[model samples]
Target: MRKNKLSFQERAGSLQEECLCFCEEASREAMFQAPIELPEGFVIDPAEAVTNVTWNADSLSCVSERCFIETGPEPDEIAVQFAVRLQGTVTLLVSVSPVRNQYGQGNGAVSVIHSAEIDQVVYYSDEPDDCPDFSDIRIENLVVVPPFYGSPLSVTGTIVLVPEPDQRSYVFTANSGDSTVSVIDTEVNTLVSNISLSDIPTDLGVTLDKAYTYVLHGNANLVSIINNETLTVTQTTPLAGAPRKIQFETGGEFAYILAGGSSIYEINISSQTITNTFTVSPAADDFALDPNGQFFYTTNSGIWVVNKYDIKTGQLIDRLSNLETPNVIETPLIGDFAYLENGELRPNVVSVIDLTTFSKSSQINRLFDGLITIVFSDDGTRAFFLEPFPENLTVVDTAQHTMITTASLPGASDIAVTPDNQYIYAAQPDDNTVTVYRTSDYTAVSVIPVGTGPAAIAM
Candidate 1:
């Protein structure tokens, strides 16, 4: 009784594998979350050079789902390549290269305007007369019907291109109140770009190949680095301190900057500079990074210590003390354990810390007062945060440390979750909106508005 869909005629030239790949529900990891045009001039080349596998799918043209794209049209260009089809794992990719035209002898028909719950796939190039008659193919879902779509390319002439597909996921929002970062587009939730940041951004990261997005700025301590294909900010770099947390380094070379709370630099993601430096004798406003990459949790509010550094020689490996004013430090996308949070405006307490055994096992208390960010649940079992004088949103079950529900997000200032935990976005800076909850029943499924003071979010 499980059938959402699945089809793939798989044929080409001479009608041999001309192309058809339909997937559905959860079969073969069916995918294609939105944005699917591409037939007109076509322009999507996420650097277009795939080798092993790791594709950023989007709709019929961009070739959705687990990936594996192959193209070969060279009278002018037709190079779409990507390959990450896993199960037994077969890697072979090469997309984006065809742009030549005028090969239309009789008729053509290449359609997939979407919404049939898609996972669309396409392929062509077995000498169908060489294929390539898109003098103005145009697309936005794609439907270029010419005169040949009857199980044939019309006297053997087939040239139907598809290229518009760039919107699988995105949600950057770092509105340091107004310095701007915005971005959203998690498949049509909208607010596509907004970028302008000169100061105050404070935390946002992504780059395991999401193509770059590292912003941290508080009083201009700077770091700005964006380039998600060209949303531009290219690089800013400067940071002697003042910024506050920005992690990455699950082997992608390196990155970890938790500024002037007593320094901790170390970046170098392909030369975005700052190779190494780590100090914290009496500084630590926030910092956490040990998703198994090897420790560096810092959080101090009035001497309640919690430092642990040494994510590769930054030294000073331990100090865990009794917590009470812990500031903020989070780490749990996979866990070795660490949460911290502490208190300041009144009642607060998260403190989990258990990097294997560096101690302080559990806490989780919160009458409110502070907890703007802290997400986890890529199977870590749940743990979300955000509760500032009743802006409420807490959900946490991290293996039984309780508090399984709460929802009201009045002015919520930051939160992000969606690696499949279903959804939960909240960033309402006084109604500039961002909402979008539904981790099963937390409700409110859409809001979007974004800009003015969005605070922080990432994914």
Candidate 2:
């Protein structure tokens, strides 16, 4: 076979043609599928002062960076500051200085700058301190030593405090059909303040550094951005096709709003405005993010492979669109797999996705009715869900990839695992109850009644 070489002019012309073709196709597809009413926000360039990296050698507090920079205390590790130039308003960052490694020394040392507390909640109850405290002497069979429990307190129903630890905590309750977020003091388990937003909170995304909280109001086509410190609404951004879920960038520069249709809205956290928009249609109601802030997964239209996207730019990097219909996408956990709540309405299943090759590693399904949410244990070894109609919790073992046990809940609409992994809280909107359970024995620790109709619970 003879090879034909083309001239430089022809090559350049071909490349330009291809690029134009792609642009036209993308534009045509967007026009055909997007809603006629345009998204209600203007795009503005971010200021240089807010996007540049400013570092203080003596204080070690890196500021003015488009994103937050971090370091640890290691004799050999030199502290360096680096930030990314974002496209919208000011960058909102909240970092905990002490918990992070001063010079990156300890084995488990972690120094976080933005939204770190949200990640810390996963480490909250990781210890085995939940065992019954037995310090008094017992006589033969019965020892009435001030009783085993401290006091019932008969909570006005139970409200769960998810401590971001060493930082701030969040309160999750079902007093309303949707969820309400509140700031809590982790040490005392007391409610410090409630995040005041004009719209009803349906879903939530809190920054890692604990600086801001993103609340999605599905019915209002709006998202309320609240400052963690002030505990008040900072900005209300708009969304396309009515928002269903929300996720934040790794740097807390912008937030991505996922809707029921084919478009994703990018909101500038600093300016509290919408800057850019992308298309990832038919995305499922939920999504997940990787720790490195590199990739995120969600379903579009149907569950085949979860759609993996680039966090820096609103671009579709890849799609694990290998699932059959009725697959519900979940965020990726520590392990390389993204947990999937699968099966249609009748026989719901949870499948594990291996990120390495974008394949299903394991899948388990059952004829359990009303499987609503999937709450994973701290170790990711077990998953919990709520069944519909006669609401209850179903515990599935990830290792065996099977439903190990089912505990009858008071009528759970949503559930959350305490950061410490010691307890699981279930929200019952119909009966106004929040059920708390011990993960070890899968037993009910407390049944605290809460708001009227709790829909979602987060730790």
Which ranges of candidate 2 are over 4 A from the true structure? Answer: 1-168, 174-196, 248-254, 267-275, 282-286, 290-292, 300-306, 317-322, 365-370, 377-382, 389-391, 397-404, 447-450
| Predicted candidate 2 versus true structure: per-residue lDDT over 1-459, tens digit per residue | 011233546545655664311111001000001001111231111121011111111211211221111111112211111221112111112111112133433322111122101100111111223211112111121111111254311101111112122445655442344345544444444445434345677776665455777777877787776666445555666665777766665566767777755667777777778887777645555666654467666664344556777755757777765565544555424456666765545565567677777678887655555356666665677777666754367777777767787777666677777668777766666776666767777677666554446666655
| Local distance difference test, each candidate | 0.62, 0.50
Error of 2 at 318 (Å): 4.3
Candidate 1 wrongly placed segments (more than 4 Å): 1-184, 190-208, 211-247, 250-287, 290-295, 298-303, 313-315, 318-327, 330-340, 348-368, 372-385, 388-408, 411-457
Q: Number of backbone collisions per candidate, in order? A: 27, 43
Cα deviation of 384, candidate 2, in Å? 2.7
What TM-score would candidate 1 get against the native? Answer: 0.28
Scored against the true structure, residue 24 in model 1 reaches a CA lDDT of 24
TM-score, prediction 2:
0.55
What tens digits encode model 1's per-residue C-alpha lDDT throughout 1-459? 001111232222312433433222222222222122336543333233121211222222332233212111112111222221222111112122222225523223222222323232332222223322223222222121222233211111111233333545788888867787888878778887786666778678777667788988867787888766545576688877677778786677788887888888888888778888888777887887788887687877888778887788878878877777788777765757777777655777776777889787877755556776777766778888776756477788877656777778677777778878888787876777798888888778799987887777787
